[model samples]
Target: MSLDPDFAILLRASADRLFFLLEKFASARVLVIGDLTLDEFLTGQVERISREAPVLILRHETTKQVPGGGANAIYNFAQLGAKVLAVGLLGKDEQGKALRSLLEAAGINTDGVFVDSSRPTVTKTRISGHSRQSVTQQIVRLDRKSDDLPDLDLQVQISQYIKEQINSVDAVVCSDYGDGTLTQPVISAALSASRTIVDAQKHLERYRRGTLFTPNLPEAEFAVGYAITDEPTLTQAGQDLLALTQAQHILITRGEQGMSMFNREGSAFHIPAFNRTKVFDVTGAGDTVVAALTLGLTVGASAWEAAVLGNLAASIVVRRFGTTTTTPEEMRVALQRLLEEG
Candidate 1:
């Protein structure tokens, strides 16, 4: 239920080293390839009930756009001082324009982003309403995307870009959201690079052996075809996931219970949740984990140590709404506080 006391001490004592590793992010290049989405949050006030329908009218207030999916992971990586190269598809539309501007403002390299005329930039809009004294809550959501895959030319361009960029980056992160960007060719090209990590919604087996797979508890259960209600079952689930995916390492993120790790050789480690504080929002927490964990591995941290850093990163991002990111300085402070409190 808690982190080992000695392990906590070690984590604390290595604070400087951890920060040093974070600094290395500036030099280590990571390629993020997959679904690039624009997340729009519209916050308004509940005005009155509609005359013709049961819905309540909302007084328009403000709208904000941020990165989502693979874009969010790239944002997290950039926030942590990593040199991130983003490779994905975006439509030649306003949403795509805004998303690219946001990424560029965050210092993420977007030259690899393919602009396909056939698809609209994937956009998820969340409408939140609040009374004068009540907290805002999401009332509805709308998604805009293209159902078809990228045209042949666009697909070929994406694959060629991956091949060209693969040899240069320190690590490759496949942030698949079942979007067309992460096609089989893209995955194959990315896996050809060194130290590839995949965070997918489903079909874990697509990524071949030696890849690192990060799937949350429910995702793992779905992939492994069972319930993971206890430690033993969780252990077995991790084992099953590794064998099913043919991955060298598997990390199962368990929200409050923390994260569980497994490798091909049968070694497993469970990292307890870093914070005892209330979770404000869990949107994009998985992206934070994938970002921090892959960054850790890029810097040569052990599987368990990387998971610990990821656990800490997730604890920070969940305290905010919409897609958010954790910074290196924030992580250092949180880890230090976790040590002192422990």
Candidate 2:
């Protein structure tokens, strides 16, 4: 996409402000409250066809695991140098244990992470195929999760935890992936206590009166019960969401097309996606956006500035693999490169 000169100029000045905000992330405190998940990736080389079926056989090369879902939001904040505390439910299983260890080792506060044995840790196992000629690609995915919400007792426990810790954080991030951790009680606790930046896959209305809503195009469409096939429709969708959620800001994240944000009064701001040619994976890009935006808002950035920072952060993370994150130094490099190219 060609940069509009006016927007390019704005990007230059805004990038400078974002550079300053990046410096304050080390001290910014955020509480991530939502579903906790483990993302597993099994990559292999397709060697030969299977005899039993018309399927290719894979020579399994490596298996990798990482924090996903709401855990990914916590990981993003930690990677960006924020003091992030996680509040969610995990399963009493090996995946949960490994995810907890990863969070603790990364210096994230996992005091609010609870465990239950009734269900397994919300997990997604992606199998990727590689060949001498083809690019690495996910061939199939396996998901292990239940649609049930957390139990009443567990909900109360999580709500109580949020109430206690909300006052300590600069902002709260509710990353709901419909994995039973974000119950009405828990969502209410976070929304009632602090400024919440939400990234939910569905049921966006449950997160009403949020400080900000960052739903991708399809999620927004789901919430509004319509198709957004053009700019006018997209704008209407933003306005509809703003009314439905009563949020101060609404940011509809359009992959490759960038982001479109609307305010309480229905004023809109659109940002183009960056570094499109370098996108390698988009698994955890939303978490990356919410982490950067929450930190930017905590450090006194305007909504547009926060969204730009998110756009930059998303740009960086998508160039990597799986549920990953980007650092301040990387943000700086990206910004500098953007400015130079502009």
TM-score of each: 0.95, 0.94
Q: Which stretches of candidate 2 lie over 4 Å from their true place?
A: 46-57, 131-135
lDDT of each: 0.87, 0.89
Q: How do the residues 1-342 of candidate 1 rate in per-residue lDDT, one tens digit apiece?
A: 245797777777777777677666566789999799999999899989999999989989999999998889889889988999999999999999999999999988998998998899999999999999999999999999988999878878888998998888999999999878888888888889868899998988888763799998889989988899998999889888888888889999988888888999999987777764567788999999988888888888778778878888999988887789988888888777777776
lDDT of 2 by residue, 1-342 (tens): 456688899998777678889898898998998688889999999999999999979999999999988888889999999998989888888898999998999999999998877878899999999898989999999998877776899899989999998899999889988777888899899897568888998998898898899999899999999999999999999999999999999999999889999999758989988876677789889999999988999999999899999999999989877789999899999888889888
**Residue 128 of model 1, lDDT score:** 94
In order, how many clashes per candidate?
Answer: 0, 0
| Residue 177 shift from truth in candidate 2, angstroms | 0.6
Please give the lDDT score for candidate 2: 0.89
